[model samples]
Target: MASTIVSSIGQGTGLNITEMVDALVSADTAAKKAQITRQTNNNTAMISGVGSLRSALTTFQDAMKKLNDSSAPSFNAYAATSANESVVKVTSGNSAVPGSYNIVVKQLATGSKVASQQFAGGSSSAITSGELTVSQGGKSYKIDVANGATLESVRDQINKELGVQGISANIVNGDGGSRLVLSSTTTGAGSDLSLSGIPELEIDGTQQMAGSGAGYITAKAQDAELTIDGLTVKSAKNTIENAVSGMKMELTGVSTQTNGVGNPTSVTVAQDNEGLKKSVQAFVDAYNALQTTITALTSTSKDENDNLVLGPLTNDPTTRSLVGDIRKVLSEVGSGDQLTTLSQLGINTTKEGTLEFNSTKFTAAMNDKKLGSEVQELFTGTNGLFERMNKAIDPYNATDGSLATRKANLDKVAKNLEDQQAALERRTESLTESLTKKYVAMDTMVAKLNAQANQIKSVFDAINAQAKGS
Candidate 1:
């Protein structure tokens, strides 16, 4: 009877059939979504792993950089001091050799200065609109003065043009309202102040204002007089360089005291040992941190529940390979010096694959003359351990390099999966629309057929009743 009723109803049950088809479509789509989800999770994990590896490599690189910069006071640098800071102060560079020197500053260098022929006032100009020429040591400059320009404006113009080396303009208020004064920027006899182009002004380094036809010589340009080890030396300026190999002495004042805190017999330049020791320890700490990060990423451990837990990068082959590569570099012997290996300086690896520095052994090595020199060479030499390791690790840590390549590839995978998911969703939507339309058509047709069948049945029953009554 159900089949007969179904035959009469035709596709009236299509909605139920469409609903079943919709369930099937959803199931298929769910499988595709599951695949996309799995791919996303896997790619995310691998990307994170690469990030960890990169961070580790960068930390190690920074540690290596410290060993390369010997100019830092913490590494093979020189420290120079002056016994008398009041009279003389000293600072040493990497090239300075350890030595002692006795120095005496007799006179400080002076630059040429001359007060201009008194002007009317500080802001007043003798000549309103004119080009003034100032020359010094065969170098000349022409300064253009604006119409009705003041002496102050002329001063600004001269300074702006840097009119002449060692020639600076100034104004002073004296018995006269203001006078234009020009001085030298340098402190030596060769650097002398001079002026020209204006007859009202006449200045010279060696001249008296009222005597002769020359202007007043306010100050004379002179050289600094000093003695190094009793050998008289003359410097054009106060700052002296390389008088003693690798030493630059700046003379501040004349010698007024003997060798002591106020003045000493020697200026000493020596190596700073404690600073280098601290640098080595810092390198050890950085190296250990890198090692710990690698171990944590590549190893497995038991969780709080005592269940075995895998590290984020435990399955990554590249991370494991990097560890092996770094270990190989660390263990290699350096051929340039007697301090060929890290173990000689007490930098040893722990059982857990981390570095350990033995301070006692390192200090002893630092004190040994033969080993100390070689040890410094080992770290700073051209093919030193730090140098070699830096080369090995550079490609991996550089941007868009090894680790970045893996991340980029994973990014592409994720994008492709996303595209696939979008296509599947559109296909599902189209399928749902097609099923709904087909079901609606079937319901409409079935209802029309049922209506016709009922109308025909009523006609047959009416005819049969008429025949029976007759």
Candidate 2:
């Protein structure tokens, strides 16, 4: 006796469920990996934005500090001391006689010293009581020197040597030519020349000295005391070029006849406080622009996505961080009792983080004897505010500094992203392989089920036919 058994499963189905599931899983994995990569990019961008804001803020603060410091705007000048020394005297011109006359010296020409051989011929001496000749560029000059001639006579002979060299030889007229004098038409190191033969006897009334080339007497302005707005300024240069910008004062009415020693000339320097005011205002304007930029970066707004567009990272945290950093750098605290803060120097910030200048307040601060001195010390000291600020931001400079570090970090992150992407691609390939195998198995199973169903139907049809024939 045989028992009947029933089973149902197989055939060419409309779709393969197993293959579909595998494909969906692979797609989900790829999308997740892509999402992680995008987040990394966003993080890198945010870091860059914050770094840029910090740098700009630092620069703005530095400029403001320099402008606020009162000492930064001061100027120096040179004053004339000697009235007669200021004038050049042409005692004896080539065409004029040697006479005493009050001659104004527009420019003083420094004298030079030249050395040349005085040839002499005799039975006892190699050469004696002969003329020494010098030639250059087809031009020559003869110097007459007597045998056993003194150094002064030899210098005098060479002094008389004349040609393209445009040099004049003479005794320092006042010093009885005691000092041999050589003068060049030009001023420079190459203008002077000297030549020697034997023994190089001391000439020019001085030890035989090498030619100093061409040189000049540094005619500096005499020190003069001038009162500017009740402030006395002493300068040693003739023209007061910096007494006021664009306005130069020439020292006139100088007592040319008198030997201007211990003589004081009085002149007034008008104060241009208006010009100083304008400069301060310009600095304020620049500072305001920097503040605006920082504010914009840190602001956020809601978008259609119902998400914060800029977020707190843009407005609160980054901007606040920058403000804190700037304030810390500018604030002073030490035993030296130097500058304390911008406000102490009359540069106070508003609620909006922009600087405001109060002239009355600033003037009062400057007038404060102790405070003013302290403020001055801050700008020129061992550990001044500017020095500290520069030290802080120096690393951000383009060459092997903070900026370089940031750039290096960015490169490292980019490389990491690339590596992650490559890893994801490998994962995806593995997923694809698994999905393909699963789909192939599903396809085979469906085919076999359909064949089994067809076989069962054919058997039932043949059995029915036999039964009918019976």
Candidate 3:
């Protein structure tokens, strides 16, 4: 506002002092401001480029992790199939040998359940509260009931006191008013559930009504009984793992028995050629995507008008170094039984820095017994392809890694630019203030000179007018 007043004053002398001062100040600061803006924009782009590169690396790593199913890598994967899915379902790991087994499910494992005698009142009826001991599979826990506990409240208390140990209680209301039902998730023989407490909830046959009025066993605990290759096997759960080597079976239903013999379901274990091919193809695709991201960040393109447009990280030393490191790992040779490098397994890097996978070659390699193991070792063994690639990327993507340090430095640069911008603003304001004061003083002087000249002209005009009149 003061500058505006000064400018108005300077205008009285027919000099645009405000415009002249603005032109001078802009000329003096334009170059520095442009340079700072250009550098700040470039730094921001570089930071964003770093993040994109990191995200691409993380995505590639996820694809690689899928191939590593366990601590001991098993790229030579296996699959198991059951002839009758309604009878059983099977899954296999790489450690399983290719073979066929006859499986017959005779019985499924079930948990035990006990029910208290029907209460004369409904589920909301009050029950005697006392210390109750719940026993399942020989494991026991005691629960203290509040004096005013109802049937439903007692059931809730039992569930609250017992967590994942698998003991639970519920009230079943039927023609027999309401009964407290106790159930267990622990399946198998010798795991029956029993309770000893007030006569209303006892099931151990100790109370006078234990035989009839007390609770009675509704379902008895029993183990899953099955036959594998003519041998009987027992398990506490329907899903049996230890019955087979590197394979597990989940029993869905019992097989139909004929003349005292249960029909058997055929289970076959074999190499999963299709699954392996898909995994390798996924790896190739992920790496190619990462390569494309790197190219977009580090290469330049042309605009519609034929002007060159620079990429975010164009000519960046760190990006070039990272690309070189990954390429070096991909080009390494390996020692294997029948394969040496990725090329032997139908995987090769194209000139554009992306991998190409040959499905036919991969399938043939997997079909060969000796080559299959070699292919597995090439990708999952010590210093394998993925291992080396992950190692090379860790330094750049880790929390305190190269990319983090670079971003921090760029942030500092941005902060410094902010400081520079502030300083420039202060300098410009000061220059404007000084120039405005000078112009205002000059304007005041001009006004005084004009005033004196007008007074002199008035006196001279009066003299001339008097002479003319004479």
Best by lDDT: 3
lDDT of each: 0.71, 0.48, 0.81
Which candidate leads in TM-score?
A: 3
**TM-scores for the candidates:** 0.66, 0.49, 0.82
Whole-model lDDT, candidate 1?
0.71
- CA RMSD (A), model 2: 15.6
Question: lDDT tens digits, residues 1-470, model 1?
Answer: 12221222235543465446568678868887788887788777777877887988887787677556644434554667888876677766556677778877777888767666666555665555766776555566777766777778777777777744646777777664566677766787666666666655546546545422334355577899878778788988888888777667788888875553223346888765566677778878888888888888778899899998777789687677677778887899997545788887789988999888887887777676435445555765778777777777776777857778877888898889889978988888777666555556677788788889989999999999999999
Q: Report residue 273 deviation for candidate 3 (angstroms).
A: 1.6
TM-score-best of 1 and 2:
1
lDDT of 3 by residue, 110-179 (tens): 8877788878787888888888888877688998887988999988988888856888889887775777
Q: Candidate 1, residue 280: CA error in Å?
A: 0.8
List the candidates ranked by lDDT, beginning with the highest. Answer: 3, 1, 2
Give the residue spans of candidate 3 off by over 4 A. 1-3, 6-13, 67-76, 100-102, 121-131, 146-150, 197-199, 204-218, 229-231, 256-264, 300-310, 314-341, 373-392, 426-430, 461-470
- A best-first ranking of the candidates according to their TM-score comes to 3, 1, 2
- Candidate 2 — what's its lDDT? 0.48
Whichever of 1 and 2 has more lDDT, that candidate is: 1
